[model samples]
Target: MGMLCGMAALSLVLGHADARGDAPPPAKKPRLVRAPAAAQPAPAASPEAGLLRGPATVPAHWSRNHCPDSIPEGAAYYIVVKGDTLWDIARRFLGNPYLWPQIWDKNRCITDAHWIYPGDALIIPEVNVVAPGPGGAGAGTEETPAGGGPTGARGPSTPGQILFPSIEETALQCASYVVDGREDESLRLVGSEQGATKVAFGDRDILYLNKGSNAGVKAGDVYTLHHETYAVKHPDSGKAIGLKIEVTGWVRVILVQENTATVMVEQACADIHLGDYLKPFERVQVPLVVEHSRPTRLTPPSGKVVGTVVDMQDDASIAGDRQIVTLNLGTANGIAPGSLFVLYKVMYPSVPTPRIVLGEAVAVAVRDRTTTVRILNSNDAIMNGDKAELQ
Candidate 1:
């Protein structure tokens, strides 16, 4: 009985110890299971991966914005780059720079040929490909004539080619000319609606004339507005021959009262001022002619008649290419419109020196003793008193 009681006491002590949370047996470690390869998440792609693909795989938005998929037949799309002009484009594609007007005609969006911006798409008209000159500058590719020196040398226009209008019609209409001091001053511009505030008038302005129904003025009658500038003297004789009459603008009578007439300004080349005289309006016909190459050599003078550049338009003393100048020779010297003249300078009359070829000009308006010429080309600045001879 003593042994049994001892064993019972020992067992109770062990139970009490276990209940008090003594150190327990260690737990088994968990095994990490590998996921299948197919179940793994895919790796992310690089940002530049799309660029590795060809242009065909490019995004639709980018390709559409950059270029057209296809252009029209017989025409090419030219994305205007910096430093591009209609003249340069025409010469590059159409073989002639003067054909720039054709391009302007085709692209009505280009209101002014003088202005073109980069990135603006232009339609290039395909024409005969002129053989490019040396350095591919698109110089005149037409073969030189028998006696003409080379392709780029100055000479007459090539035969069997079309002639283009060299001068604009408006330029011809506004050109100044000379007349004998015999113009009738009976009809004149007297006042305007804005005459009190404005000293000059332009197109679409209303004006009043001094003459009316009593002086034979009628509605729908067009008159040229002119004013006497100064007397043009002969360069050689220094004698006054004719008056330099400047065409300020044109006017058309709208209503005629007993002693006054109401008129509207049709075109204004210069400022239309009060006291401007009026004459019967004559339509000026500008000629269509080939622009001849400038003469480079010491070509013999035609001896038709020699003259001097007395004055330039707008009181300018120096003139360059495309500037208007007045010559002392005119109808009395057999000078006529469209006539070509070679401008030369005799540096030393005493020394036997060849006349230096300065430039060339074309007569646009001819009067009795004076002619107005448009300088076609000038190697140097042409000034008053420069010598000119018919070519």
Candidate 2:
């Protein structure tokens, strides 16, 4: 017909140029109405707003919430007197009066270790011990009373402040302020040496008392140098001589160094042997710490001396001197009103300190407990219907 209408007008102009290149069909993806990853709302773990999401063992810088630095640069004190007792002063300076709460948590200035008051003055902190792996920097951190933790918003048990690889931030010598324990005669010996996990001198190690100045020990006394799993017998043919030993080690005087002192050794558990034996458990019993001062000028009672001295005097009341007297149990032992009694003469049966030079009174003096004393003048005319021991 005219070439079939000229191929139908070139097939209708190639179907209108293939519908203008056909690209408008992709505009239909709006079906993704995925407004349902379960309807949103689920992202609140630990931005710290009450933190506590999971796995944080104690890593908020080690968590103590920060409060440290209360006098740690090498501390040691011990004064109190008159029959002193906090389990006998933590069994003579922390050999274990059950540790007296580690000296009442290192003294925090003593809240109450039986009211400690006799002239006060008692701190013995210092436990800087850190000997773990790579550089070792651990000590002090153990607080937890900021208030309302558990995410309520009172946090800070120990969170930040590590600096001590060079060693100098040392606090914890029982927290200072004095009060908890260590005053039945003070001079210390605490310890360190990382507790000798295989201590050696021939192998090239030689550190028997890391820093307690070899018993002149002071600076918070707290030794270990451990390895006493028991069973070394021989106190009287008990048997069993050699099984596992480099011998004893258990110190407790935080900081004291006229030579070299600084100990912690809480408990080495195992491995420690380089001539071990850094002993002494605290018995220096009253060398100085008489800080109960309050008599700014009230000095009275030069002759009022209450009774209790049933005979025992060696000499020491030097403000004047007029010795001679005796009584049994007058004034019920309270005998205050100027209190001062020394009269003691048993001759023997008082000395027991020997755990490696006991707190060292020059290595060993308080031995037979030393005796002989005098001075007693208060007892309503002092009488003794029982044993008679007053002066």
Candidate 3:
């Protein structure tokens, strides 16, 4: 009985010690079982992430809140890349695939729409689009005006409102003639619009000429009207340089006859008389651009002042703004309509400089031996003896 009690007491003591939590940890998994590799963090976004987006996709750079109704003028451009097509480019930039020809027309370098190399920059012209808005129309959604634009911003048209001169106005404003000693020339003004009764004529008047089909005159052909007024004498030499031909008007052949042609006076700067001469008209070159590229002074090859302002349309001794003046230089001296020139006065008799800048002139009509210049602007009065140098 004593031995049994001792064994029970020892077992109870061991159970109490286990309940006190003095146990060892379990063993880890064996070496045969492998673990997974750690996951990598994603790469940072690229700096050009917005630029590389496909053309068909709306650019990420566009503001979501404020889309435009039309592409503003001179706003956008595209750099050509390999495998780019005009169709895709138009759709991407102009928002319409059918407008691909617009792109082709603008980019002259694209000789063939099918073949385009990288690195060519293309201009994206302004285009109208129906931008979605709260009212289904937006800020630039107005209809074009009747006379000018879709926005109705052109207002109304009025007579005499046009400040800039028209082609006919600019052409007919001056006169150009080459006097070659044809006093009894084959072509001459036979009579005025009022039969042979009228002595003088004006613009838009009918006139009779002495030559027609037999002289190879066509119905649409234009002619210049002039008469040798006086002989232009050289200032120093006292010898005759060229004849001073007074340009009276111009005419367009209308009716044809065996030896006569009826013509309408297109313009008459002076009174047109019966004895005025007629010569074939010359077309005007040189575009009337908003700005002309001209040298500050005369350039070489045409450096020297080769001509002088011999006459004025108004018959005034001095010419001011927008006055017409005649120059000795013509097509023979490489002068053309739209040719720029600087008018300067000689302070001293022999010295060309310091050039007294009289003004600037533009050649509106160039003839064989003389040119018609319109004084564009002048700081002072432009005289007849003023010098002209090509720009």
Q: Which of the numbered candidates is closest to the native, going by highest TM-score? A: 1
What number of clashing residue pairs does each candidate have, in the order they appear? 0, 67, 5
Q: Rank the candidates by TM-score, best first.
A: 1, 3, 2
* Range of the 10 consecutive residues with the lowest summed lDDT in candidate 1: 3-12
The CA lDDT of each predicted structure is 0.60, 0.26, 0.52
Q: lDDT tens string, model 1, 105-146? A: 555565334445555455654332111011111111111112
Q: What's the ranking of the predictions by lDDT, best on top? A: 1, 3, 2
Segments in model 2 whose C-alpha atoms lie over 4 Å from true places: 1-107, 111-115, 118-207, 210-220, 223-250, 253-270, 273-391
Error of 3 at 152 (Å): 41
Candidate 1 TM-score to native: 0.58
| Structural similarity to truth (TM-score) of each candidate | 0.58, 0.16, 0.48
**Tens-digit lDDT track for model 2 on 211-264?**
435535655444433232333222223433222222233434454555665443
Error of 3 at 215 (Å): 3.2
Q: Candidate 3 has which clashing residue pairs, if any?
A: 143-150, 144-149, 144-150, 144-151, 145-149
Error of 2 at 356 (Å): 54
Please report the candidate that would top lDDT against the real structure: 1
